[model samples]
Target: MEQVAEKLGRPDAGDAAMGKAWGIWYGSDSTAKRRDEIAIYSSYRDTSMRVKDVKQIRITSNAFKTQDGLATGANLEDTKLKFPDIKKLSSYLNEKKDTVVVYDAKKEGIGFEFLKGKSISLTVHPVNTAVNDTYLTLHPEWKLIN
Candidate 1:
């Protein structure tokens, strides 16, 4: 945790229980109000940390890109062009009242949460359990795009 904090310059906030996640903010204030430009989360098995997944939000710079060169701020068409195999799983209004589309690359263990016309966030996880088990088990209606 200290190493990550050092590299990311101290997380503005964190949730030790929620998959041991940390929110890294950009710009001044360093609070939730400033917006968590980046979110880092780790999965655990038994007492061991299994894997880490990093998510970025509203990132306009070209510093980060997917394996197919898709980046935040890109439109749905651009995502489809980059990841031809991408599959749309569902769509709903997010807490922000924005229409969010969820896309998944089941084989690649990657998922994207796009807000309306532009890509907003990207999440990568293990294929065996791309999403939280509790949520999946509880809401069987929510299916992954296979």
Candidate 2:
């Protein structure tokens, strides 16, 4: 945590808790706001939580791009062009009650979250592991997207 604070400057403490994961957020002040927010997650209160290793990094800005130029705000067609093997993984309603679609390129270890056909965020995970194999929060009511 100190190392991240050193490299990225200070981060705002995330107020919400999701299961056993704790989020540390950056760019959330009035100057940057939520649009430029980046969230880093760490295991919380579990036996393994003591390590505090980064479990997830959530990017909500287009300023950061993948080597192939994928970023937030990209449409499904554009994302498909960059990741031809990407497939609809699942769908869930966010806290806002808006439906979000998750697309995964399993071999690439990257997934894109789309809301209304536009990419809203991207998730990185271990290559070769399905999204279902990760620590991502799951909704019992999740809908499988074809």
> What would the TM-scores of all predictions be?
0.63, 0.72
Task: Using TM-score, give the best candidate's number.
Answer: 2
lDDT score, candidate 2: 0.70
lDDT for each residue of candidate 1 in 1-146, tens digit (9 for 90 to 100): 44556787876654555564445445453553324255555434435555543432223233568776777778878877766677887776544555667776656666677766877666665664443321222113433333
What is the TM-score (0 to 1) of candidate 1?
Answer: 0.63
Best by lDDT: 2
CA lDDT of each prediction against the hidden true structure:
0.55, 0.70
Candidate 2, residue 6: lDDT: 80
Q: Model 1 Cα displacement at 104 (Å)?
A: 1.4
- In model 2, where do residues sit more than 4 Å from their true spots? 15-20, 26-34, 43-50, 136-146
- Regions of model 1 farther than 4 Å from truth: 27-36, 48-62, 131-146
